[model samples]
Target: MASSIHSPNQQLAYQQARQHFHNQQNQKIQIFWSNQTQDIKQMNDFKNHSLPLARIKKIMKADEDVRMISAEAPIVFAKACEMFILELTLRSWIHTEENKHRTLQKNDIASAITRTDIFDFLVDIVPRDELKEDGLGIPRVAFQAGAGSSSDHLPYYYMLPHHPSPVGASGMFYTAPQPCPSLAYMHWPQLPQQEPPKTDT
Candidate 1:
């Protein structure tokens, strides 16, 4: 009996099969925030009294999950932080206003943005290397100084994205698999149309 020899096509088929197997093995489930619409609603509720800006900031800063990921992935961490802060600020403003039951008035959003110091602080913090370091050994004093010393009249809140990815078909698209939560809001209108703000760190 003659021994069978593998042809080039057979070898190529084998390689393809192996590659597919490996690809399947490498696939993983990545959980992330899927929608900003929900965040807007949550912010409105937060404004109405479910959660406060200060408390939200404390949660974002102290949450082990957020802090652990934030050290190595500053941009993502920063964006998440920014989003959280914005939501908290908006919520706080809505709750304080005379019309608590009204729809999210445009001025309320603007006032929330203006009153919340976290946005500007984020503009500075997101760019710093200290916040990106392993262990995220950022000093408390540094945060306080940046937030407190700034002459700008912005009120401080800790709402912001710890991780922010772009939105597009190629980017993260809103879909059923990833339901949009009530606490997700993107500063899309506020963000420049060009590339995302660069990380200075």
Candidate 2:
């Protein structure tokens, strides 16, 4: 019987192929939130205040569960817009020296939003715990390319306001995609046992 063989190079190639598949599966989903119309007033306010638009976007995106509602969505969009402004404002305040190096902690987010009555309209809407401090706190230094060593620390805890408690909610409000399984093993399969060629043929 002829035998099948795999060289070392072939094995290496197979491993690399599997890694590529896993990487592709783990790719994160990106959600974008932009102003529908040029709110000259808001733009001018931000510019004059030196608020960091880039950082704001980063914060929103980092929270994988939160998505940017489209401006055309009216109610939901409005709520998200309010949240954005409140978040930016809180970030600015936390970064201020008076905050004692805390940066704009997550708790600050809840406090700011609640104080501003941003999500007050929804019935039974309260602060959600899942949005609490991420433990990473705020960046000690400005964020720049190759600025400094990366820190794996979790963000600090902050307040999070939720409309429905996880227990009270009818169904889960946030739904995440299932993790994609690894495809590395797909390249190799067990060969089936075969009987010797028929001698009487």
Candidate 3:
């Protein structure tokens, strides 16, 4: 196993390596942010983008209620999506390095989702086999069986348009059920439902 890394000095060396990896990752993100700033400042063409404007428009109009879209809206969403992909790639690379792998793999992305809280909504979508193979157990539920509200388990922006309501008490504490779906045809990309990844270390 890659984790054959034992011994105090070896552990220290491993941690230091990880820390260095993290520092490099941070620097890359900062550079990206700086480039994005420069692009925003100098770019005059709003009609063209790296992501297809038509595709972005289609995704925005996926909501039945969304009948109209502005030119700027798609541009904004395209940039946001780009940032999300970049961050996910960087985070996944951390897992790849930890596993001593050169090629990026599915398990790396799954590990990134399991470790990142903002990606919590995606936990249900990672395949059971990938999560298990990564040695990070499946996340079977959105929240843990513990004392606290859904707010305790999730970031503030999870499952937009559907807020969690009190789903009765687990003895003295309230356990949150998955939030009820609001629009049936919103067409959120449904991954074949697998057991949710395990939240425990």
Candidate 4:
């Protein structure tokens, strides 16, 4: 029994470190949900948005099958983008902590993507220069990603933009995509505020 307790401290430390991370994340999830609930309850300000609705609509329209988007769709997509950013950052932060670093490096995000099955969809999105396969033919990282929620709507789930870089036969390195700060601060109204459309009645 005493021998079992003498295992390598590095492994023990990592276990403890991740446990602490999970604990803190639980608290964050609670606050996140609370804020989302509040936003849903008080979402009357359609005129103001953190992301450019026009750009979002343009992206959506790029798909050949997508035509005639509703006014509410862009608003939903903006919220989804915000949530995506939060999730990506949260996963990357875990890798940063594992490496005993405070700053979230691009590698941390790449590692997170490789380790997370759900984020597997994003493997293709990461640049080839950022990630390389380990000796075991796997991305050189280890970890888990999780989300807690009971109130997510169906459209919200379907609308989240997922662009995981694909792991290829070459075992190439995949770099994390740069975050677009402009999206979150695009508060300026690009279009002129015109009167509501007239009805034929």
Instruction: Write down the TM-score of every candidate.
Output: 0.20, 0.21, 0.57, 0.54
The candidate that wins on lDDT is: 3
Alpha carbon lDDT of each predicted model: 0.45, 0.43, 0.68, 0.66
After superposing candidate 1 on the true structure, give the runs of residues whose Cα lies further than 4 Å from its correct spot: 1-86, 89-97, 120-201
- lDDT by residue (58-89, candidate 2, tens digit) is 54555555688343344333445565665546
Off by over 4 Å in 2: 1-83, 86-88, 91-98, 121-201
Which tens-of-lDDT digit does each residue in 148-199 have in candidate 3?
3343323232453364445533445345443333555477886887998889
Q: Could you arrange the candidates by TM-score from highest to lowest?
A: 3, 4, 2, 1
TM-score of 4: 0.54
Top-TM-score structure, candidate number: 3
> Model 1 compared with the native: what TM-score?
0.20
The sequence of per-residue lDDT tens digits that candidate 1 reaches over residues 1-201 is: 775696677767866765564344224101113345455445432223333445455545554435444333443344456767556554435433423455655444544444445444443333322323456764333222222225222445555455544555567753323333333664445755687878888
Q: Which model is ahead, 1 or 2, in terms of TM-score?
A: 2
Residue 151's lDDT within candidate 2 is: 20
lDDT of 4 by residue, 87-183 (tens): 7787778657657898988777766676555666677666324235755555543223222122110011123237545654578755564455557
Candidate 2 vs 4: which has more TM-score: 4
